[model samples]
Target: MNEQALSVREAIIGRRSVKNFNGQPVDLENINSILEDARWAPTHGLRNPWRFIVAANKEYIKFQDVLKEYGVPKWKELSEEELEKQMKKFRTPGAVVFVVVQEDARQKERLEDYAAASALIQNAMLLAWDQGIGTCWKTPPFIDNPKFREELGVKPGERIMSMLQFGYYDDIPKGRVRTPLEDVVTYYGIEENGEEK
Candidate 1:
C-alpha cells in the first residue's frame, strides 16, 4: 500500500474497544458529529429507519435501574463487589447511543430496518474511532431488555440494532488478532483434476 493508504489503514486498525473510562465527559458536539456522519450511510431502500435514543442524562440512570429491577441474573444476586462492578459499568463514559430501528413500511417489518441500521452503526463506530473516542456496541443484555429501552422512552414501534457508546479512554484496550481473510473467504473454482480436492 502507498503512504496515503497506509495512513488510512493505521487509523482503522488502531481502533479498539475501551471498557474502562475516566471521569471525562464527552460533549454533545462530538456525539452529534458522529451521528450526523451516520445519517449519510447508505441503506438498501432508503427508508432510513434508524432512530437514536440518547442515554446521557438521567435516562441512563433510569435505564440502569430498570435493568436491575427487571431481574437480569447477573444483576439480581449482587454481592458488594458485583454491585459495585455493575454500578461502575456506565459511570465514567461519555454517552450511550442507542441505535433504534423504526418500524418498516411496505410490511417488510422492523427487522430489515435493524439490519440497515446496523450498517449505519458501523459508520458511527468508524466515525467515533476516527475522532479518538472509545466505543462498545453493546447488545443482548442491553438490547433485549425492553424495560430499559422503555425507560429511555423508546416508542412501541422501535427496537435496538446496537448501541454506539462514546467516550475518551478509560484505559487503552489491547486490540485482538483478527482471523486471516483467507480462512474466512473462498473462491468458487474447480479443483485441478475436477475432483473435490
Candidate 2:
C-alpha cells in the first residue's frame, strides 16, 4: 500500500495511462484490493457484469509465449533483436487483466452491461493510480479472436472488454488538455431570442 492517499478528484485528474513500465511485478494482492474497491462502480439493474482474468508474476512469463503467438504475428521469423524490441510492450507490464462482460441477448441489456464494465475499468484505474500503480486500458483486435478467447478461457455469451495492464513507472506522463465544457456542452432551452434552440 502507498503511504500517501490521494483525494478522489486528485486521482481522477492526475492519473495517466502509463505505457512505459519498469518491469517490477505488481503483487496479486494489490490488484485484488483495487478490484475489490472498484467493483462498487455503478451497474445497471444491480448486475455486476464484469469479471477479470489476470496474469501476473511468474504467470506473466508464461503469458509471454501466448503473446508472441497473437500479439506479434510471425514472431518466429523476426531477428532476435527485432523480436525483443517488439516484445518489450508485453514484457514491461507487471500484470495483465482481461476484463470480461456478459453479452446479454437483449440489445439494451448488452449495452448496459458494457457501460457498467466501462465504469468498473475506470474505477480500477483510479484506485490503481492512488496506490502508485499505473494502468492502461487496451482493446487490441486480437482480443476478439477465437484463439485468444480460448487462451483466456473466456466463455460464450461473454465478451472481453479490455486488456488492462498494471505496473510501476519511473516517469509520470504529462497530462493532455481536454476539450473545454464550452466546446462540448450545450445548455438546453437557452437562446438569445429566448426560444429553444
Report the C-alpha lDDT of model 2 over 29-110, residue by residue, as the tens digit. 9899989888999998899998999998899889989988999989999999999999999999999999999999999999
Candidate 2 off by > 4 Å? 1-4, 192-197
Best by lDDT: 2
lDDT of 1 by residue, 48-70 (tens): 88778776545555555654564
What TM-score do all the candidates reach, one by one? 0.76, 0.94
lDDT, candidate 1, at 139: 71
lDDT: worst 10-residue window of model 1: 1-10
Best by TM-score: 2
Model 1 residue 181 CA deviation (Å) reads 1.5
Q: Model 2's lDDT to the true fold? A: 0.92
**lDDT (Cα atoms) of all candidates against the true structure:** 0.70, 0.92
